[model samples]
Target: MQKLIFSFLMALASLSAPLQASEPASTHANITQEVNDWLNTSLSNSPGAFSFELRPIVSRLKLDGCTQREISLPQGNRLVGNTMLRVKCIEGANWMFNLPVKISIQVQYAVAARPLAANQEISTGDIAMQQGDLATLPGSVILDPATAIGRALNSPVAAGQTLRQEQLRTAMAISQNQKVKIIFRQDGIEISNEGIAMNAAAEGQPVRVRLDKGKTITGTAQLGGIVDVGP
Candidate 1:
């Protein structure tokens, strides 16, 4: 009778031991799910439509049951491309971890169809739409061919090179040493004078012009080579 009772007690203890161990596993699974859900939500609402690849956490961290978990991007870090994100458990233990994430967005942007020379005006034929991952590209890429066409290149670009906004500018509406009408308005009075453009400029940009009296003045360039100067 005594031996049977001891055997029964041992079996009950063994069963309870496994049940107790499973608790930590369940908590770990819940933490992973929470982190994944946060990542999916953040990536889905990013600037462009992107596909994301998340690296698996190397080691399983057995944290306490968390009542609250917060995920945030690192300072100055855009939620795009390869970046690190910080996840913190605000409740239970208040622990944090950094997660590695990769984001890729398929984009159609303008590229140079041919080798373009510096100061060359971009024509319709010079720009072509190319499909690529925007996250992997550099600088502010030009998305539309219409925006690139009719603009002058600031520097020469090789064929197949991606077009960037900083690389192009509006074609000069006013040229250097050209005649321009400088208009000024003050106190309801309008004045106009003829000046020579000392520097070339695009429409709506500032230009330096030499007045008829040989004095240099800076004014805003307008259409038809007109410069507006303010008193």
Candidate 2:
């Protein structure tokens, strides 16, 4: 009687096995598609044209079937450099994946036409346009020639070197100890006063000025040695 009961239980277990096997599994193609869709959206607003390719997915790895997926780049990554994109199943499964990516971005930037000296003022002839991948270049590379022209370089630049925004300085609008016109406007009324500048400052830069009565005030330097005393 005991052997008969054991045989009956084994038959019932076999009948339920098919249901578990049919539950489902995640496929490699679906995961790769999700990554491609996400990458295209993230780079849509970049300054220049870009392209990316994902490394081949592991074929033998298996995970729970995913109904929904969450994709993101690691923090501090802009998705332009060779980096890893993370895919996590937010529904129907609890698995995460990291896929390697190869990126190529093309952007136009200014490069020095010839060797330049420190403190040399820039002109239109000083630089030429060049194109390269933004990921491998400096973060602050100057893309517009207008931004670099008329500004003085803080350090020497070799020919073919990329021009950076911070390497140039704006022309000074006010000289130290120079007399400047102080302008103040309120309710459409304008007032003009004279002050002695205490320090040299470039346009839009703060400068200290001493008034006639030995008083000092801070104001922004402007064109023609004018100091804007009020908004």
Candidate 3:
């Protein structure tokens, strides 16, 4: 009878040991989920639509039950592109770990709607909008159709080619030898004169103008063939 009692007690202890070991595993899963939730909430306000990829923690950690977790980014780190996040347990266990993250955003940019020849003036019908992963495209991609419209292309672009700011030039807003109104404003006083543009220039760009009596002056080109001269 004594031997049977001892055997029964040993079996009970062995069965209960596994149950105690399972608690840490469950806590670790909860910790991982907490970290994930924190990251999603933190980046909810980022520009454009984004998706996140989190690296799994392979090493086993013996951490106590954490009452609070603090998530932070490294100094000078942006939420875009590939970055790292620091997860620290502010309450209970005093431990920290780094998580590798890859952030991808969907971006809409302008592209050539059809094959365009060199020196061709770009119009509203010449461009189209395209959506793609920003990380995979060039850094100089043009995001707005308005920016590309009315610009002259410097090189031939294939159909569906992404438009870049460097690939286009501003269309001439003022033509050479055109009659223009030259205005000068200083100390709340306004002066106006008639002048002929000496060179073609884009809007908001500098243009040389020939005023009456063969006087020449440089001024900024404005809309409606107007030039602004500083006193």
> Who wins the lDDT comparison?
2
Task: Decide which is better by TM-score, 2 or 3.
Answer: 2
Model 1 over residues 137-183: C-alpha lDDT tens digits? 87498876888878899999999999999999899989999999999
Q: Candidate 2: minimum summed lDDT over ten consecutive residues — where?
A: 17-26
Each prediction's whole-model lDDT (CA) = 0.83, 0.89, 0.84
Best by TM-score: 2
Report the lDDT tens digits of candidate 2 across residue range 1-231.
Answer: 999999999998999888667646878898898789888888898889999989988887787877788999878766787888988989888988788898888999999999999978899999999999998999899987999888889899999999998899996788899999999887899999999999989899999999988999999999798998886
Task: Write one digit per residue (lDDT tens) for candidate 3, span 1-231.
Answer: 999999999999999998666534226667678768877887787546889888876567666656777878988776667888888888766788887888788889889899999978899999999888777778788887898878988899999999999999987778899999999999999999999999999899999999789989999999789999887
Name the lDDT of candidate 2. Answer: 0.89
Rank ordering of all candidates by TM-score, starting from the highest: 2, 1, 3
* Window of ten residues with lowest summed lDDT in model 3: 20-29
Count of backbone collisions in candidate 3: 0
